[model samples]
Target: MSSKLSDYDYPLPEALIAKRPLPRRDASRMMVLHRDSQTIEHRQFRDLKTFLRPGDLLVLNNTRVLAARRFSDDHGIEFLFLEKLGPARWKCLVKPGRKMRLSATAKIDNVPMHVEEILPDGERIVALAEDVDLYAHGSMPLPPYIGRESDPADDERYQTVFAQTPGALAAPTAGLHFTTEILSEIPHVFVTLHVGPGTFRPVHSETLAEHPMHAESFSISKEAAAKIDNAQRIVAVGT
Candidate 1:
């Protein structure tokens, strides 16, 4: 059967939307829909450990969220880290797009960043002032739906415990549920996919095939890939 766009539509109550992370990472609820019985099982996320076996490889993105929000002259400007095009050169999405220009200066908590160049779609290439560590000075790149400034706790909770590479603009929400305890119980491998702003963008095409997927750079080391390929089963977390 051909799948139509309408067939994918389903109603979700506003109250069911998760506006914030659960108090405990593993405390969030999960709904398992069984196709054969047409039944839904509501369970806690931690229960996933009971269903998995040894040699099951869980693959997850370990890209760290960049603290890209900057404040300048009491005005707020948001920059989403896209990719590191070169040493000290990065592709980023700027907010209040009209105000940013080539050679423009932006400050994150007073740490200066110079706009090195501009790109298509109102994006900018920016370089931070020498010796400035962007991760230390920037704020968490929270999702737009949250509609609030990123808090200090977000710096830790928004990122996966295993995240090492630092370049993602958003949190891989599905991975956030895995705690160190859960990770120790199940074998997992990490890969880097510097997710850009496009991950959050709505799919615009009437047909799924017509929707363009934004290219995200990902890399898995040969050793990691070999482990994944040889595993008895694989589970992917998040987009």
Candidate 2:
């Protein structure tokens, strides 16, 4: 009913948000809304089985969340990896802009990286050594919305049951609700779309079409593409 972005905002009490996940992956509650009846229902995520038909195809993104946040206290900056540019180069978002000048260099976990170039959007092109892999030592790049330090538990909780590629800065949060058993019981195919930094950017335009989009990489296998092409109905899970 409102076009103003600010008008769509509402108060979200801190307690209403679950800071940590339940011990069981599929134990979280799901809110279901029926369109025809204009009714709402509350149920566990496991109940999703009852609503699906035999021919319905579920397509899921299997991109794994990377531990892409590297902090350099000595430089007073943080580097959030977005995507790779080459064997050892990456597109990154740097923090405390004032400190990371065009030619700045830092050692994350003692792995050297340099700010090769600064983009118009303020992101940096960081170049690491040819044999270096900073993600192996960096911490999870948790969304700014989460207000706590990333811990070891996040290493597991932030990953999906079907994660297959290691490039997304953030997890497809919706995919985390599905357990291995649930996916096993469903008719599904996997596609990879390494979530990019843009996943966290909010829309700034008055309409969806007016918003500028950021780039992300995705892949679909020939078999998966064929299955999707022949499916009676398709459901893209965990957007």
Candidate 3:
């Protein structure tokens, strides 16, 4: 049978959605699923090391989140940058996506932008009028479920300890539970996967098969690939 969009939907209590990180990076709750036995266990995030074997191979995604969200003009229409098309040109997702017409011009935090093209996937190609300090005025493009505006703390805690590249619109959330102390005990390989905002996009289509999955760029180093290839078990850190 085909899966319906409703089949994948579940009710999440609003209170359960964390507006901010826990006081400690490793203080979150963890659920362990045992597929073979059909058993489940609940534990603290810091207890993860207890379940892993000495020879287990752990792989981490090290893509960093960018301050990609900016207001389009003073009215506060939002543009979440997805990727760089070229120097001073970016592909972005405009909120109220229908409001942006072809050949329209908008200012993002005082940086003038020209709408060059609209892709079939609903992303807009925009050309900047001048170089702007995006980080100075832009905030992290957090997921909708966060239910709060980005604060100063997000600039640091929203990123993982291993993040190195600054392209992801969203954080590799699975890695968010790790701290430097916890990470030091684990032997791991690093890979890059620039997460896009589409990760949180809902499947509006009736069936799951009809919903298109958004693509994100990722790369694995030769050293990381070799380690993964030789490992007895692979533990992926995040989506």
Candidate 4:
């Protein structure tokens, strides 16, 4: 049967929402699904290695989260830089799109930014001035569910230990539960998939088929591709 958007909906209590990270990364809860009997079990992240068998090629997304959230003035207007379209032009989503119509401009952190084009789905292609340092001025683009402002600590907490690439608008959050100890014990390789804002956009259409999918960039190395091809089983491990 084809799925409607409501088919994927389930009741989620506000109390169950985790607003902050645990003191230890590996201390988070893990839910295991066994295919043989169709069983489910709850465990800790520390037990992950036990679940993997020999010759399991663990694929990890090492795309790092960009400090993409900038404000016009004290969060009066939020500017989320989604992707760099050109040297100075960026694909972005501006809050209050009605106010910032086509060609609207603003000075954020002393850097001039202007709307170059507007997409029909409420995204805009914006142009930034030379030497605009988002890493220095922009805040972490935390999901709205977090319900708080991004702090300095999120710079470290939101990224994976193996995050070598720098392009994702949002974090590969599943990687956050991994620790150095766990990674050292597992057979894993890195891939890059810089997440875009569309990944988290809520589905408003009656059917999921009606949802407009946005593209995100990705990269895979030659050696990683070879291993994946020869592996007995491939287990992807990221959001």
- Per-candidate clash tally: 0, 0, 0, 0
lDDT of 2 by residue, 99-188 (tens): 778888877766677788999978899887565676777788877777787999999889998898888989998899999899889999
Residues 1-239, candidate 4: write the lDDT tens digits.
66597777799998899889998999999999999989999999989999999999889999989898888854567888877776877777888787578888887777787888888888988787874665567789999998889999999998988888999988888898898899999888899999888876888889978888888889999999999999999999867
Superposed Cα RMSD, model 4: 1.7
Rank by TM-score, highest first. 4, 3, 2, 1
Candidate 2 off by > 4 Å: 1-4, 73-75, 128-131
* Model 4 regions more than 4 Å off: none
Q: In model 3, what lDDT does residue 219 have?
A: 92
- In candidate 4, position 24 carries an lDDT of 92
TM-score for model 2? 0.91
**Candidate 3 TM-score, true structure as reference:** 0.92
Clashing pairs in 1: none
Residue 6 lDDT in model 4?
76
Candidate 2: which pairs clash? none
* lDDT of residue 98 for candidate 2: 70
Worst 10 residues of 1 by lDDT: 128-137
The residue-level lDDT of candidate 3 at 161 comes to 88
Q: Candidate 1 residues 1-239, lDDT tens each?
A: 54356678899786766767878988888777778999999999999887677778899999888886655655767666666676667677877777678888877656677888886656788886654545556688777777678888888999988888877878777898888888888888888988777866777778777876677778899988999889899988875
